[model samples]
Target: MLLENMKMAFHAIRVNKMRSFLTMLGIIIGIGSVISIVSIGDTMRSLFSSLYKDVGLSQAYISIGYWIEDVRDSDYFTMDELDRLKEIFGDRIAYIDSAPSISGEVKAGGNKLKFNLSGVDYNYQNVQPVNMIYGRYLTEEDVKARKQVAVMEAGAAKKIYGTEQAVGRTFRTEVYGSMTEFTVVGVYKKEVNAFQKLLMGSSDDTGAAFVPWTLLTWPNDLIYSCRLFADPGMSREDMNQLFQEIMFYIAKSKGRNSQDFRLTTAMDEMVQVDSVMGGLSAAVGGIAAISLLVGGIGIMNIMLVSVTERTREIGIRKALGATTRDVLIQFLTESAILSACGGTIGIILGIGVVFVGGNALGLQVVVKPAVVLLAVTFSAMVGIFFGIYPASKAAKADPIEALRYE
Candidate 1:
């Protein structure tokens, strides 16, 4: 019986092929819009979540004496405060790394490469650590002796040596004052940075070059930024309170009661990413939904016209043995098939757009399974909803009057 109704519906659609195609347009567009937006968002979210893991666990490196105009700006721990903090917290305090960021060009193997420079102490590795692929990381001896040593990141190493071994090789770094020479004490494999390509538009040069603080320029400017991982079973709340107190101490020293610095943890980032992306994601989804609504309305308009054109046929069927239910079901089936076909095609087109946008242009397209299922379901709902009133109106027509109509 279902097959028979669908067969009749198909015949009707084929007879009015152009109208059927036009009716399908709304469902097609609605599905396509949703798929495209969702796919991009999903891709970006996955990419960034991976990046966040590599960004080090939540604890911020507190700095000092910058362009802080307000008292609120000075609300963080400083270099001097970290020493006292260690005394108060002891083994629970994790690692402390104090460094200032700078850019430098180093000449190695007669090749010059620009690199991010960090003048690190012994505890630097424990805090802002990287995987060492060649040689060894900077040692306590290196820091104690104030050795003029430098370590290259993967991209810089490749540029300097062209796949040759960088360990023990001498490199020249032109500091502000004079040219300094250092032996390559270590080489490291770069971290997997998802954002590197997305932000830089290139996969090369993500590794940072490391140097002993005594050997690098800008010595006095080295403030403090510490990384404190929780102990095996310590509560995050306790860690936060401890860090807060440490910041307060620093704030007091600077003559400010409140520490004016940002304190971000993994929990904080988790909340932040959700809050920011949630709103943006919702806005995108909301905008796409409007298209679906418009499409549904278009279907209703087209279905109404279909009712008027088929009045004579409806009358003839009623006058013969066809019940109102059968007529209504037949019309509903036609709308359903029409919209469903359009939705299927739209899904394919939308996915194609997602692929082109993501791979060709490197834009983020993240499609949720739920979104696809919802799009399909919404399309069906639109079809039935819009088709219903028209089908019912046709079923209610008086046979004598409908047959007499032009």
Candidate 2:
């Protein structure tokens, strides 16, 4: 009996193919919008994770909280204290350094080029490793002796010296109103991925140069901030404990409260970013879901029309001993099938959009199975919820009155 009812419902839909398709249109658009939005959000999260991993997932920073309390010069980190820290936590720490940078113009090969000169130590490479195309990176000797040597990007070297192998070449720049010459000791490859170019524009005339921190700072320079990279083997809990220990050690050594310093990790930044992205996605998705309500109304209107048009058929089925429950189930099944088909099409369309967009942007596409399942279930529920009034109306029709009607 159920099969016969389903067959009749399908025949009705087939006879009015255009109306059936139009009825499904709203559901298709609504589900498509929701799926695309969610998939894009998932892709963005994946991109962020990949980017952070590329840079250094275990990176962290320690900064002096002068805003919390006035910091005395005596409270600053000293070179000796840094060495002691290395001795104490060398195994757990991959690298630790204070990065001091200055922006200036350098005259190389008669071209004035803008450059950012970063001061770093031998351990800097361990934290932020770069591919060396020529010569070598800064050494312990270079930091200790405060050598006037620099490592430049290969592209910058070619612009300055007409070749990527610009090792032993010299470039002059003005520093503090004094002209200083730095010999190029190494050239590293500069990487610019698609996503970076989209964000930072072109990397043409601008380049970076690395020099020893000792050359940039005085013997008594006060260090207010430091960057630290933990060993890859360290867990989040271990890293947190290490941060606490380091803060305590520094506070005790400098005779200040541990609260006088602050530690920020990449994980913390990732969490904030994730929260922001999730909220944005949810807000946009909710807005898109308004179309689903519109689609549900369309379904209800069409179902009402269907009930009125089939009044004579309903009366005949009742005369043949068809139960009201059977009539209700048949209409509900028809509505559900319409919604389910629309949802299936929408899922395909949405996933296609995500894949195309992700490929174009050089991003990874993520379409979770759970999300698809939820969408399918929700769409079916919408059909059933709206079909209730129309289905009930058809079931409660009086056989004599319906039979007498034109």
Candidate 3:
């Protein structure tokens, strides 16, 4: 009996193919829009999460709040104090470095190319590893000797000497207000991923170079801050506790209030980013879902019209001993089938859009199976909810009156 009702419903839709297609159009557009928007949002969140992990999610920065307290040059971190901290927290800390940077320009072929000169030691690589394309990174000997040798990024090296392999080449930049020449012992490549490029733009014209931190700092120079990288094996709670202990130790050692220093971790930024992205996605998805309501209304209107046109058919079925429940179920089944087909097509269309857009933008596409399932279920429910009135109207029609009218 159910199969017969479904067959009749299918025949009705087939006979009015154009109208059925027009009715399904609304559902297709609504479901497609919601699916695409949600998928893009999830993809973006995943991209950012990956980027944060790649950039060292276990890393943290420490800075002095000069405004909070009267800071003295002696309160700055010294080599001996840094060594003591390392000795005490060797197991918890992976690497710590006071990387001071200066904005300088290199004169190349009558053009001054701006570059940031960062002072780093051999241990700096452990904190922020780089891939050396030519020659090698800074060594312990270079840092100990305070050699005037530098490692240039590939883009900067090419800009300076018209080649990426600019090893042993010398470039002059202002150091301590005096022109100092340094030999490039190495060149490293800085990889910019698709998402990074989208956010930070092209970094080909501007680049950075690394030098020995000892060369940049003088004896008794105040190091106001440093970066600390925690051991990857440590959990988030342990990492946070270790950071707080370090902050307290530094404050006590320097004879200042703990409030004088600030500690920031990459996880803080990650949490904030996740929150913002999730909220934005939900808000936009909710907006897109409004169309589904419109589609539901369209379904209801079309079903009402169908009931009126099939009034005599309903009368014939009733006269043949068909129950009111059967008439209701038949109409409901037709509406659900129409909506389910629309939703299936919409899912395909949405996924196609995500893949095409992701490929074009060089981004990773992520589509959740749960979301697709929910969309299908929701579309069917919408059809049933809207079909109730029309189904009931058809079922309540008097067989004698329906047959006599038309």
Top of the candidates by TM-score: 3
lDDT of 2 by residue, 146-259 (tens): 898999999878887789998999999976567889999999996766666565556677778899887665546667677678887899889878878988888888787888
Candidate 1, residues 156-217: lDDT per residue as tens digits?
A: 67777876358888877677568878888788876444455665555464335788765652
Worst 10 residues of 3 by lDDT: 197-206
Candidate maximizing lDDT: 3
Model 2, position 258: C-alpha lDDT score: 88
Stretches of model 2 off by over 4 angstroms after superposition: 1-7, 158-163, 199-205, 218-220
Mind sharing the TM-score for model 2? 0.90
lDDT of 3: 0.86
Q: How well is each residue in 144-165 modelled by candidate 3, as lDDT tens digits?
A: 8989899999988888788999
